[model samples]
Every structure is written in structure tokens, then in C-alpha cells.
Target chain A: MADYILGVDGGGTGCRATIADTSGKVLGTGQAGPANIMTDMDTSVVNILSATDAALLAANLPVHSYSRITACLGLAGANVSGVAAQLQQALPFANSSVVSDGIIALQGAIGDADGVVVILGTGSVYISRRNNSVTMKGGWGFKVSDLGGGARLGQKLIEESLLVHDGIYKRTPLSSALLKHFDNEPHAIVRFAHDARPNDFGQFAPLVFEYAAQNDPLADKILKQSVETIEAALDASMHDDQPVLSLIGGLGALYGPRLSVRYQPRLRTPQADALTGAVALAAKLYTQTAQS
Target chain B: MADYILGVDGGGTGCRATIADTSGKVLGTGQAGPANIMTDMDTSVVNILSATDAALLAANLPVHSYSRITACLGLAGANVSGVAAQLQQALPFANSSVVSDGIIALQGAIGDADGVVVILGTGSVYISRRNNSVTMKGGWGFKVSDLGGGARLGQKLIEESLLVHDGIYKRTPLSSALLKHFDNEPHAIVRFAHDARPNDFGQFAPLVFEYAAQNDPLADKILKQSVETIEAALDASMHDDQPVLSLIGGLGALYGPRLSVRYQPRLRTPQADALTGAVALAAKLYTQTAQS
Candidate 1:
């Protein structure tokens, strides 16, 4: 049996790997470039391997020790057709399984409990687990959905800025800042958005939040609309059993207090990060198989 | 001086060319494949030439008489930096100029009259004219703006369909039809959207309108929201002298009755189509230069 377990959390932005013992004691963690399986499977595999190798090296283990490690990889685009299967077949670990990044986030947030985790980052998704059965809402991606995520917020800000430029929306300091950022050229914003990825748009999300704190009306309007969508998503994810809710991701804490009062009592902090949850999953799967 | 005037209306879907005498009398018209300069300038040039050649042939003129033509091209993506200049230099005519597709649409709708034309096709844009002075409101393109256009409606349909699939949104006949169309697979919708262009999403716009006609509540809600945005755009377009309002494009007629009653009295039918408008502009420019 493998003496070590590995966990990988891969997304469009980057890939992170954690190495731990069979008993769930973490030894080291490492990160590498993006590993979006849907975009490029080969690159994702390479990134996963690179992150794993670095984690093992950080744990004082030989790079070749990869073959003896069982791994669970949770990655964005894993839910796409044939992506997870392809990644599992391409992985170098002794035994490995691939799942969506949302699943790992849910695992990390609730740790086998019946609950839900709403990740608000460059993208947004709601992952719920009840008695080991898992379901998901949203996370269709940036262009089609992701409602209240940073990317969506940033996109709304740009749209409002352009409207202000056109004299359609009232000009405010927020819109002025955005127009100035793009050199006061509507075409520049259009050109930038034409080829921009979610993370690229998410970079402007902080500006929206910053302006909102200063009571900018447009910023406040954008945030209010965003929170309404997020609230709707949260309401849709609930059940009579009242699963504990944990808001997770880079923007999670910032958005948490703005959520409806009804959800206040149900909100809980995550027990571990997604990387730890991935390693925990690896340990659970490998140990069970070995005992059987 | 050029003996003939040529007008070309080029867009992502296709390109149309019209040939007319210097007196503004139509000679013939022709069409070819898409000529969006931003995606492939070479293809745009080829398509434009093909349409022009066909138009000359239909006009019973020698194909080699292209040099006698003064062409005015109103093309999608021409407004992008360097595109119009590149196209102007590449066009095969005695003299040529390039303008945005929206400009020709506005010209077609209002002639030389000071007015506003709101185009509601696969994309949306508001173009206003006052004493030869032109200003634009919303043609920023899909995913960022184009709020009430076919592409946005179709994209919203897909998003709602996915939400219904995940039980986040209530299932209606519209969402059911959409799910059935994609074989009830959320992944299929995701895959289709992942690589879909604006026109691809625009293909689903008819479905939304069809369902709305059948009184589907979800469809009505979507349409209401879309119309509100469009109305906001129109209101923003109004100046001290209320310009004659012209609603144009494939979805324009359908949305006309739904607009606020205040715009009804001002709404007027277009005097000519975009192709004719292009030819008219070509005649006006070349004729003036010939006389001068």
C-alpha cells in the first residue's frame, strides 16, 4: 500500500498540491500554474504533476516517490465530459480519482457533514452535500453565469462605466476611475473584454468594492444587484433539513456580512482548506481499499 | 471621377453589396459570406470583393469596371482600431471609406433627418444623428453590453435552463424545451456555450420569443427585463430636441408595441434598408466630389 497520500486542487488560475501521511498529517504543500482541464488536458496534467513533485520534494521525499502516492484531484472543468476520466488516466499516482473543484471546496468547508459551501471568487458555485449525496448549483462559467462572483462584479462595473461615458448612466467617481483605467476610451474597454478571462476581469473587482465602501451610488447599485442574485442562489440551495452554510473563496469573507439575516445563524467557518480536503479524501479512499 | 457608387454592408453573419449610379438610382445588389474584419481581415476583404463583383455583374457592367466605383462600406468591426483604415486601403475602387455597421443602419432608418435608431438584432446598439453629428450608445458587443439584443436574450435563456436543471430556478415550458433541445444534459449546454460565438447564441433568440408569445411566465419575465434595459437605453438617447425614433432589426417590430407608449408617436418606419443607405452615402460623397 502507498505510504503517502496526495491532494490536488486545480483551477483556471492555478494548481495546488498537498502531501500528507496515511493518518492525515500534512507534510507539505506546493502550487503551480493553471490546470483547467477543459482548455488543455495535457497542460493540466503537467501542472498537476509539477505541483505534486514540488510538494513531495518539500516533504523531503524523492521526486520518483510519486508512483507510490494515491491522489485525489479536484479541479475546475473536471465536470466537463471526459475531462476527469482523461485526467485520472494521465495521472502518475498509484491510485487516483478526479472531481470538480467545487466538491473539494465543499469537503473542506464542511468535512463530511451535511451542509453547503458557496464559493465566491473569480467564479461562483454552490455545492451541497446531504448524507453523502452531493449536488451542485451555478458555476456554469463566466460568460453564461457566475452571478455574484468577482468576474461578474467587475464586468458590471465596466458596463456601468461605459454607460456613464455614453451619458446613459449617471457619472460617479467609480465610473470615472474605471474610464480612466481604460484611458477613457470605450473602445479600449471593449477590446480588453473581448479577450479577457475571468481572472482578468476579477482583477477589477477590488475597485468596485473599494468604491462601494465610499458610498458610490453606482457601486452600491452593482453590489445590491449582485447580492440579490447571490441570495437567490443561497435560497435555492436550502432544504428543510437546514444544512450548515459556509461561504468560501477570496471574496467570501467580504460578501458574508452582506448576506440576508436569515442565513446568519446557519453560516459557519470552514474546517480546512480545499487542499487539505483533497488529501483527506485521498487518505479515506486508499485506506479503505487497502483494508478491504 | 467614379461613374458608379458602391455600398457594402458587412457583418459577422454575411456581407451585402449594392451598386448604384451617381444619381442614387439602384443598379443591383449581391451578398457573400461573413466579413467581420476583426476576426479575419483577409476573409472580410475577400467576401467584400466577391459581393462587389457579383453586384457589378448583376448591373450588366464589366467586372473589370471596379476601378470606376467609389465604395462606402459600413461594416461590423470597422470601428475597431486600424480595421477601417486597413479595409479602405484594401478595397478595389477608385476611392473608398469605411464606417461601422451601426452608422449605415441609422442612415437607413432616418435618412439625413436628425434622429435615433436603435438596432435590436443579434447585437444591439443605439445610434443618434443630429445635423450630421453622430454619437453611439451601446454597441460594445456581447457578454459586456448589448443588453436587450438577441444574443443576450439567448444567453440568458441558456443560463435559466441550466438553473432549472439544477433546481435553482423554476422549470417552465421554455426551460423544458431548452433542456429537451440539448437532450436534457447540462453538460451539453455547457459545451455548446463554451465555444459558441455571438450568432450561435443568437440562434436561440427565436425560441425565447416563441415561448413569450405562448405566455410562458419565465419568458415574460425575461422579456420584461430586456425591454426595461432597452427603454433605459432609448431614454438615455433623448436630447432637448427629441429625435425621430426608429426601432430597427429582426426583433425590432416584435418589441415595438411593448415599448412605453411615449415612444409610440415618435416611432417611424425606415425610409430605406442598410444596403440602400450605404449606396445613398456612396452617391452623396462621390457626386459632390464629381461636381466640385
Candidate 2:
């Protein structure tokens, strides 16, 4: 029987590792670089190991203690065909299973209760759980998907700012502020965006919400359009038999109040985070297996 | 007097060089890689020389003949502050002047006559000349600008296709066709977009126009929205006096017919390509100086 359990929460921004005892008591936590498997499977795998090693060290366990651990890894892009299975085979843990990042975030947010989670950070993912069956939408990544995501919002902000710069669109406080941030040079913003990652774009997301509150027309358009995408996703997942709903992530709070009135009453704060959910799942899966 | 004249047209897609004698007869022409100064000035400079050397070779002129060549380079991003001056200092020529790509295209289109040119390719730029004064709009680069250009159109196609895949958007022929191109896997598209350059996305542009002609709803929306941006840019650049307007570049022909009725009467064909404009300007500026 394994002596401990390991949980990994990985996404576009970073990877996190949690080590806990069989009784579900947390030991230590650690973090590492980006671990979106679809972006780079090899890089994700490397980051996972690095985070796990850091967690083990924090727990005062030897690196080889991975042999005594059963792990549950919740990874971004785990929904892609064969990615989870491939990762399963590659891990050094004694026994481990892989699940989507959305699954863990849902698990973390609602615990054992049936519910839905709209994660709106650097990337966006919509996940619902009813009677333990989970449905996931979006969270594809920054390139083409992740509608209503921070990266997309930030991207639009910059794009619109340039339009304002060219007088093609009327200038607003948001565009004015963004132009100033880039030193009033559209080309400077262009240079920043050319090599920027999703999180880099995400940094500008809060400004959209901040400006929208001030009645910035451009910001209102950008945010409302994003909200429309989010509502559409929610419309598909929030069924007739309503489940508890939670909004979670870096931009989650900002987006929560912006959701349509139909969803306002259903919204609840998450009980915990994806890392916590990962740790709980690891303990339950491994300790139960040991007992059986 | 310079032994030969060189004309260089550089943009995001590639650069072209032409070598001719003082009498305005083109001796040879050559092409090289992308030379958008905003994107990468060093790369642009390198491509300019590579294309020039090939043109010189074709004209039976030594590479060292650059030292005695009076040249004019019409370059994308030349309007960016200090870029043109920096480039002028860096070029190996007897005498040279730098102008925005729009300027050369304007010269090439109307031959010192009053007119406007809308270049719609992997990128977009609006340029108009009236009474020897030039007005340029857009053409800032793909990351934050290029609203109606091929790259932006293709990007929207992929983004919408993913929405279709998620069932948030109704499927259309255009989305279906694009999904098929990416092997019906949204992840493949996400992968493709992660590292896709502007021209890479531009490759799918013609397909949008093709599908739009069939009344594919998504394609129509995408095309119409792009047309709106084009019209807006034109509205800013096209004056009340109504100068001759020529739509040029890879997608220009497709965009021309779709323009609003207001621009239809003013539409005309480009007299020559950007390279030809560069050559004519080179010959005019240098020959005029030599004669005087």
C-alpha cells in the first residue's frame, strides 16, 4: 500500500503539486512552470516532475518516495485524445490517474455536490457536474478557443486601442489608458503582443472590468461581448434541474457580477481551489484502494 | 551619376527588388523573404540585400554595384517613427530614400496622379494621394492591427470554427469546411494557431471568400465584418472629391467587388505592382537629380 498521495494541478500558466497523507491531511505544496499538455507535452511532463519533486522535498520525503505514492494529476489539455493515457504511462508514481483541469477545478469548487464552475482566468473553461458525471466546454487554449477568457479580453483591448489610435474607432478611457500603458505607441503594443503568452495578455484583463465600471464604451463592448460568450456556454450547461454554480479563477470575481440575472441567484463561492481538489481526490482514490 | 537604379518593395510577406537603367527600362527583378520593418527591421534589411543581389545577378551587375546604385525602398512599417531614417542610414547605396509601402503603391497605381490604394493581403494598409499630399491609415502589423486583412479573416475563421465545435455556434459550410481542413479536431487548430505567423493564417483567406460566395452564414458574417472594416478605413482615407481608388494585394480583387456602392464608381485597377512603383520612383527621383 502507498504511504502517501500526490495531486497535481496543471494549466497554461503553471503547474502545482500537493502531497498529503493517506488520511487526507496536507503535507506540502509546490509550484512550477506551464503544464498545458496540448501546448507542449514534453514541457508539461518536465514541469510536473519539477513541481512534484519540490513538493516531496517540502514534505521532507526523499525524491524516490514517488515509488510510495499514488497520484491523481489534473492537467490542462487532458481532454485531448491519448494525452492523459500517455502521461499516465510516463509518470514515475506507483499508481496514478489523469483527468482534465476542468474536472479538478469543478471538484475543488463544489466538493461532492452537483454543480457547475466557470473558470475565467488566463484561460476559460466551463465545467458541470451532475450525479458525478462531468461535462466540459471551452478551455481549448489561447490560440482559437477560450472565449470570454482573460487573454481574449486583453487581446481585444489592445486591438481596439490601435483602432482608436487610427481614429477608426472613437477613443475611450480604456483605450486611452492602454495606449498610455504602451507609451502612446501602437507599434509598442504590437511588439508586446507578438511574443506575449496568454498570461501576459491576461495582465490587462482587470483593466477591462475596471474601465467598464466607469462607462468606457469600448471596455463595455469588449466585456459585454465576452459575457455573451460566457452566458451562451452557461446556457448550454445550466440545465432544467439547476445545479449550484460557482465562478472561479483570477478573473472569476470580476466576471461573477457581470453574469446575466438568470444566473445571479445560482452563484456560490468555491469551497476550495483546484490544488485542494486534486489533493482530496488523491487521498480518496489511493487510501480507498489500499483499504480494499 | 549612379551606374544603375534599384527599386525595393518590402512587406510582411516578402520583398522584391528591381534593377534598371536611367532610361526607365527594367533590367531584372528578384524576390526574397518577409521584410516588414515593424516586424523585424534587421530581417527586412537582410531580405532587401538578398533580393537586390539576385536582381543585380540577373542584370549582370556585380554585387558591389550597390555602392553606385540610386535606390528608393517602399517598405511596410516605414511610417513608424525613425524606422525610415534608420533604414536610410543602413542601406548600401549611392543615394536612397525610404517611403511607406503605401507611397510606392500610390505612385505605382496612378503615376504621380491623385488617387487612393487599399492594400489587402496578409496585412492591410490604406493610402491616398491628393495634390502631392499622402494620407496613410492602418498597416500597423498583425498582433494589434490589420482589421480587414487576410490574416485577421483567417483567424476569425478558425476562432469561429472552434465555437462551432463547442456547439456554442451553429455550424455553417464555412465552419464545417474549416473544421475538415484541421482534420475535424479542434485541438489540431489550436496547435496550428499557437505558432502561426500572419502569412500562415493568410493562406486560408481565399477559402473564406469562396465560402462566403455560397452564402455560408458564418463566412458571410466574417466577410461582411471584414468588409465593414475596409469600408471604415476607406471612409477615413477616401475624400469628398473622390480620387481614383484601387484595391491591390492578394485579397484585393475579392474585397473590391464587396466594397460599398459609394466606392464602386471610384474603383480602378492598379497601373502596376508595388515593385513597379518603387522602380518608377527610383528612376524619377534619381534621374531628375542627375539631369538637373
Candidate 3:
């Protein structure tokens, strides 16, 4: 009975949904608020539904036409145990599957082909698909992991600035500027960090890259460290028979060139965005279920 | 008139009070729960009072005799802008001085002499005294600073374990043991870290040392990193005319031997504990006030 495929990409900041036909023709797109399931499942579900309703309305479909849609949701925090199952159970659709945001990103970047996608957004994750199997590295979250992500880069910047404050590290213009951003008050930075989310820390990441571009020693050091970590993660995710690698997300382009030349030729542009991949997956699921 | 001097060392874990006469002869001691001023000022004050009252009772003095005590409180979180002044105003005593826990630890370790005390407990701070002036390095806090503290060491351990899980870092008994402790579920570790306090992370520190002693490569790497950071902090705190260096706190002895041999000859045994240093400060304050 499904007439349309719905692709949803949900994260801590916001949610986006797209409506497409089986032939992959886009019908409409919509957006809503944060939908990170682990933090607030009810809110995430609500946001997902709201985005889907908007997409359906934009497609000139009735609000009650959800039963004719097969949805594939790729969400941040969906990898947490019980989240995907709970989300699948809660969704109001003809057929739906919930997966991690990274998976959709990988699929969107490379389509049905076997390749790798390195997501370098507020957080980081390296996901690779081979044949029909997929594996991942990193993206373990912030403070403990997400080594080369924007949040980690910003966090290290704050730490180095404090070290400069304590005379443990040589002060630089980059560090001085970072300290000035905090009003030169270490306690204020501490207070801010205590309750900071990943995005809050990620806000400082662009400054790091900007300073590094000017050959600021401290900024260069931080970027080098981050690059090394990302390289290690990419290396770990690689297999002998691996396909092309695509860098994705906000910091993807910034990090791309900084990576070693060995990885340059292996990098490929993503064929489509995550929402397109989500719809592609929805279409595949609809066809398979119909045959079954 | 005040007849006795009181020294109080308060931290995030617990509070300790020592009662002494003007000559620094220890009379009695008492203990109570955490008294970190910034986190909970009212509880800190209450715990400080409770510990002082118990110390008085143990010294065979009446609890009502608090007005006769000149108290010195060396408290964690007192370095924050208004914590010391706020705590001083809230005290119930003949006179009181509130200084950082690191200051009292340095004073207790070397008496009136000049020296540096490197505190390596649940948190870290390097305090140095030269003549009548004092300076500090490191000990900004955990996750931002506190580089070589137990919390940082444990945090590194968890990070390595996750890397091992991701195959980015090689597996070792140390990493395996840590992963097992978390039920082999990465999500469990993430959940624990989401709400973890410094002490919670510090709880895993001993295992890192234990594994290093057994020659676990991953453990050795973490320790080396921590030692390097600590050495940097120690070097930064050292002045041209710096006095003896004393290592203090729970992991002090463990880290002492691991430090570079060049710094070994500079280390000295503490003359007394932080509580004793606190009492000495109280006595000194009382004398200065009386002379004025």
C-alpha cells in the first residue's frame, strides 16, 4: 500500500525529512527540532513525526497518508541499545527501519557501493560498508572519545590555553586569543566547560583552523594532533579491498587536505546527501517487503 | 580569648580537622563528608563546623567552646573568586582564614620554609613558595586540566580501552580488564561517563598503575603520557631559587619514583600533613592579630 518513501536524518540539533518516489524523484523536504533519541525519546519521536507530516503536506499528500509511506530514519544516538527498536515501534508508518546517523551518511556518500565515509561534524565517526556488511570506528561520544571531532579540537584548545595560563606551555597569539575569548578568567572557562555540550565546544573549533591557517604554532600543534588521530582512525577502518573514502560533515573539507597525501587519491565526492540515501534505503525496504 | 588553633583540609571526598595549641602540638583530629565550597557552600560550612566540633570534643574541649578557636580552612574549590571570602564570613570562630587546599598542603609539607608541593590526588595542583610570595601551576580542573591527576589517568585508561575496542589501539590485559569491568558494553562506559564525577573516574586509577607495574604496554604508554605532563607542570612551577620539592596526596608515592631521575634528588619528605600545616597557619594568624 506504500506509495512514497520517507528518509529522515535526526540529530541533537534538528531533524530533517524527505519525501521521494520509488524511482528516487524527490517530492518535498521538511525540518524540525532536535531528535536525539537517547536524550529524549518522546521529543525525538515527536520531531520525527512532525518533520514527516510537513514533508507529506509539502508533497500535497493528506496528513493521514502516513500509512502509505515506508520510512527509513537515520538518527544520532540510535546506536545506543534499545533506541532503534523503541523508535521503530513508536513510528507511525506503513513500514520503517531505524539506523545510526553514520550508516545513512555512508550510504548517502557512496550509494549501494562499498566505500567508507568519515564524518567530521560536532563529533566524528568512520563507517565503512563492504558488500552487505558494515563496520564502524570512533564516534564513541565526547570527553571520552570523538578524538578528532570539532568538540575534541575545541576542548584541547581550551586546555592548551589553560596550560599557557599556568606557564606549563608557551603562550601564543592563538592561545592568547582563546584566553581572551574566555575573558582571561580560567574559572569562567571551567564554569562553561562543566555544563558544555559537544556543539558548545564545537563552536570554538573553527577558530582553531583559522589560526592554524596562519601558522600559529599552538593551533598548528592542535590540528596536527587531531589530524594524526583521524588518520589513525581512518587507517584502522581500512581493509585491503576497501573502496573510495568520502569525507563528510561541517569540518570535512577543512580536514580533507590536512590528511596525508596517501589518502588524497582515495577520497571521492559523495554521490548524494544523507536524506537521499535515507529515501533510497526506504525504497529498497519497501520493495523487499512487498516481495516477501 | 582564643585558646586553641584549628586546621581544616576539606575536599570533594571528605573533610579533616586537626586541633593544636599555639606551639603546634597536635591535640586531636576529626573527619566528615565532602566540603567543596563551590559545589555546595552550605554543606561545606556545615561539614567544616561538624569536623571542628568533633575535633574539639576529641581534644576534651566543649563543643560550645568554638568561639575560643582560631581556625584555618584549606578547602578545595576555595580558589574560585568568592569562595574563600564567603566561607570566612560564614565561619563560627574567634578568627578564621580560608586558603586553597594546595596552600595548606605546601605549608604542611615544609613548615615556614620555601618549597613546592605537587598534589596528585583526585585532582592536581602545583604550589610553590619563595620567601613571602607564592605562585601556582596546573590544577585548573579535570577534563580541562588536572593533567596528571588520578582522574586524568583513569580517563586515559577508558579512552585506550575504547580505542582497543575500535582496533585503533592494540589490546592489552589492562584494556581488556577495563572493558570487562564495564560488562564489555561500550554503551555502559558511555553512560557511566555521562554523569561521572572526578572521584568516579579516579576510582579506576589504581588499576592503571597496577597494570603498568606488570608491564602492560598500554598502561605504560598512559603512565608515560601522564608523567610527561606532570613533569611539565613541575618544571613550570620551579623558580630559579626554588626550594625542595615534595610530592603529596594518594598517588604521590606512586608517581614519585616514575619521574625522571634528574628531579629525584630534589624531592624531600614532608615535615607534616596538610591538617598540621593548617593548624600552624591558624596559630600564626592568631599571633599576628594579637601583635597588631
Candidate 4:
């Protein structure tokens, strides 16, 4: 029987699980939706398990075929008190480790080393690892912080739209274009705000960047403020004189240039995804628990 | 017949009005809640009227008693389309003028002369006035911009609270105190967040500041970032070779020391309130309109 390892990145927007064999060969991957443990714990757990089953099927292996199975899941809202226990109890594996989505991101970015990994997806977090010990820097879950990520950018975009609506901001083609995209509905803006989530709002960030690229004042202002927020987070988190910092997640590429300009003197991109690091950590954990 | 003026300054948190005679003597003042026109149009009008009534009663005059009464209402959300007209139609004064709250703030600070006025109350806006012309700066409202106001600061505080909740932020006395404060009941944080206005959350700013003064790392970080925001707003609003800048609103005094330390050579404190400026403008308008 072949031993297997699985790593899952469960986010607010979606769920993704990657499977690998003991020989470190990529087996298969599976995807699902709305798997943030904080907002929808039950659905997230169900989706994560379904994704795992799908991954096993994709790999042409039955769940019970492996002599040993280890899984690590990095999930949104997993940092909420008692969430780890809840997730672990819910996500079935021969052996499972549940940690905040940030932990897996840190592991994925720099395996088993002391360093900081900044995740910029629908939300953001900074995770630092030192000697198998984990320290987190950010990822307050959309209600508070997560600056320079998608939601923050999106909030800025909507705000610009409102300003254009009010004539406080000089409307550019971009502003008009966005307003039209929302059907000129006055309540459209308010409704969006009412049901807004970090990633849900983050979807508008690219538009903001596009407008900024086109030299719109409102968009430009939004971009600058976003950059400043991310920079400040980096500054607050990277307290070491010379810390090894990495950026990951969906917005990672989009925010790269700005982050580089502001923090490259003290930061660098990681070479791996959080899933990979999670797999590695799970394997190590298996070894440790097995030894103990 | 003692000519009187009615002055109003309606912001995000409340509406403030004053009754005064032509010599700039303030006879009475009144306040009412949450009158930002952008959020509550009818309520904003009613708040202003209520405040006006209160001011009249305070002045021992009937609403219709003052001969040659003039009014200037500097109102938030007045920049919205047709909002100025709507407010004018609702106001009781026969001779009245309306403008964005920013304009009245600028007038209160520099009195129609060329300079910049940075108003930092529940929200923030910067205005630049030259002679009879106005070149508006910041004050995009809470959704779009508002660099150094209580709302932005409150937003930052909420973000920090999330960070602390997520364990990304280091545990500090400030965090615990904040958590305890918000932990009025189970899931009180969530309930508070869902219902919180910028000012409601901003009521915590002084607490954050107090902790920072006592050397709490997280609080210190929050405030330093706030200061940077003010600096940025000032920078973006003022063309380097432009006129001297003035600070107004409640937060101005709190921010003055730090702002002065950095930009003292160019900073001035306004001696008048937004309502005073509105009254002054009203007086000027009354004399002109009567003569015309």
C-alpha cells in the first residue's frame, strides 16, 4: 500500500486540495466553493471533505488503499477560537493537522525555516516560522484588516464610484464605465457594500488598477493608499533587522511591483504554494507523532 | 430689528447649528444626530431643522422672528447631485445658501481667502480656497477617501482588532483590553461590527491613543499609521508652493502636536467652528442679497 499526503488551501472564496504520494509525486487536485471556516463552518468542512474525496478519485486511489494518510488544511477563519479542533474533527484523514490558513501559507512559502510569508488573496496574512514554531503577523478576517488585498482595493473602487456619483470626484471614463457596469442603480452600490466580503470585494481591484494605469485620479489615489497599507503591514510585521519575507496568494502577482518597490529592500517572493508547504509539514508531523 | 444668521455644519456623526447676530456674537447652539445627507437625506434635513429650532429657542427668539435672517448650511453629502437644492428647499430661512461641508470648513478656517483647511471630525476633507474660487482637495467621504478623520482611524482600529483576534498580532494589554471591551456578550464583536458606524468605532480611538502613550506596540503602530495618513492627505492636497494650511474639527487638536512636529512651518489652527464660518458667510450673503 502506498502512503499518501494531502494539502488543502481552504479560502473564503473557494476550496482547493492537492494530493501527493510518498515519493513526492503530484497525484491530483480538487476544487470546491466557499470554504472559509469562519463564515460557513459546516459547508466549509463538507466542501473540503468532498474535495479530498474527489482528489483521491482523480488520483485513481481509494481512501482506504493507503497504509498511512496525512492531511494539512489551511483554511480561512480557522484561527477563530476552537476552530482548529472543529476542522480537524470534521476533515477526516488517517491523521490530520488543522491550522490557520496563514500557517500553511507560511509553510508553503518557506518550509521548516524562520521567515515571513505574506498572503494577498481575497484577504491577507503574514506568517513567520522559526524552528518549527509558528508566528502570525496578519489576517484579521475581513472585518478589520487585510489592507492592499482584493477587498480593500474593491472597497476603494466602490468608494470612487460613489464619489463619481456625488461629483466630488471628477468622473473619468473608468468611473463612468464602472457606474454603467452597475446599471446606474443607486442601491446597487449600497447592496454591494451590505453583502461585501474581502474576496467578493477584491474582485473589483483589477478594475481599480486598470483605471490607475489609465491615470484616473480616484483610481490612482486608491492604488497609492492600498500600497501604503500593505507597506505599513510589512513594516509592522517584519521587525527583524533583515527578515526573509515572501508574498503568495492570488493578489500576490498583482501587488508584486508595488510591494517590491516598497518592501523589496527587505522582502522576496517564495518559490512554492501553501499546499506544497502544508504537505511537507504534514509529512514532518507524521514523522514526529509517529516517533512520539 | 436685530439681524440674525442661522449657521449649520452637518457631518457624518451629527448636525450642529448656531444662532448669531451680525456682529459675530453667537447667541445659541444646537446639535442632532447622524445628519450626513448622503446616508439619510430626509433625516438630515429634519436634523438640521431640529437643530435650527433648538438654536432659535436657545436664543429666546421664534423661528420667524429675526428680521433679515440669513443661513449658510455646510453639509456633508451636499455634494451629491441636486442635494444642495433639496436642502435649500427644506431649510426655513428665507435668505439661505448651501455648500459642501468642506467649503464651510475652509471658510471657517481661512474665511474665503486662499489657503487649505483640513477638517478631521467623524470624516475628513481638505479644501483649498483662493479669493472667490475654490479648488477642493481631499474629503472623498468614508467610502472613497478621508485620510485623517475619525472614520478612517476607526476603520484602522477595527482592522487592528481583527488582527488581534486572528493571533497575527502579538498579544498586548491594548488588545486584551479591546477584546474585553467588545466582549460584552458572546459574539458581541460580530454584532458590534455589523452595526458599527465610523464614529461608533472611533469612540475607541482615544483608548488606543492612551494605550499607545503608555507604550503598547500595537496601539503605537495604529497611531503612527494614522499620522502618516494625515501627512499623506496634506501632501496630496497641497501643491508644495501653495498657501499656508489650516487644521479644523475635533481631531485637529489631537493631531496638532504630531502634525506640527512634522509640518509646523506651514500649519495654522483655525479659531472658529464650521458653524461660525457658515454664519459669517450667511451674514455676507444677507447683506449682498438685501442690497441686490
Best by DockQ: 3
Give the per-residue lDDT of model 3 (tens digit) for B100-167: 99889988998777778999987788998988788887777886898889998998899889989998
Least lDDT summed over 10 consecutive residues: which range in candidate 3 chain B? B234-243
Point to the candidate with the largest lDDT. 3
Please identify model 1 stretches exceeding 4 Å from their true place.
A31-50, A66-68, A80-95, B32-50, B78-97, B239-243
Q: Please name the candidate that would achieve the greatest TM-score relative to the true structure.
A: 3
DockQ of each: 0.61, 0.65, 0.74, 0.18
The worst-scoring run of ten residues by lDDT in candidate 1 chain A lies at: A234-243
- TM-score for each candidate, following the candidate numbering: 0.91, 0.92, 0.96, 0.67
Write model 2 residue lDDT over A1-292, tens digit each, in one string.
3488999999777999999888878888789999978658888889999999899889888765778898999987788899899889988888898999888888799888777899998888889887778888888778777878899999889888888888778888889999999899777887788788888988999999998989889989999899999998888777856569999998888898888888998899999999889888887788677887
Ordered from best to worst lDDT, the candidate numbers read 3, 1, 2, 4
Give one digit per residue, the lDDT tens place, for model 1 in B1-292: 3499999999888999999888888888888999989889999999999999899889888775878898889998877889899888887788887998888888888888888899999888999887678888888989688888999999999887887887778999999998999999887887898899988998998888888999998899889999998888888886657558888998888888888898888889878888888888888779777777
lDDT per residue, candidate 2, B45-97, as tens digits? 89999999999889887775787798999987788889999989988898899
Please, what is the whole-model Cα lDDT of each candidate in the order they appear?
Answer: 0.87, 0.86, 0.88, 0.73
Chain B TM-score of every predicted model: 0.92, 0.92, 0.93, 0.84
Give the CA lDDT, 0 to 100, for residue A52 in model 2. 92
Q: After superposition, how far is residue A141 of candidate 4 from its true place, in Å?
A: 5.0
Task: Give RMSD to native, each candidate.
Answer: 2.8, 2.8, 1.9, 7.2
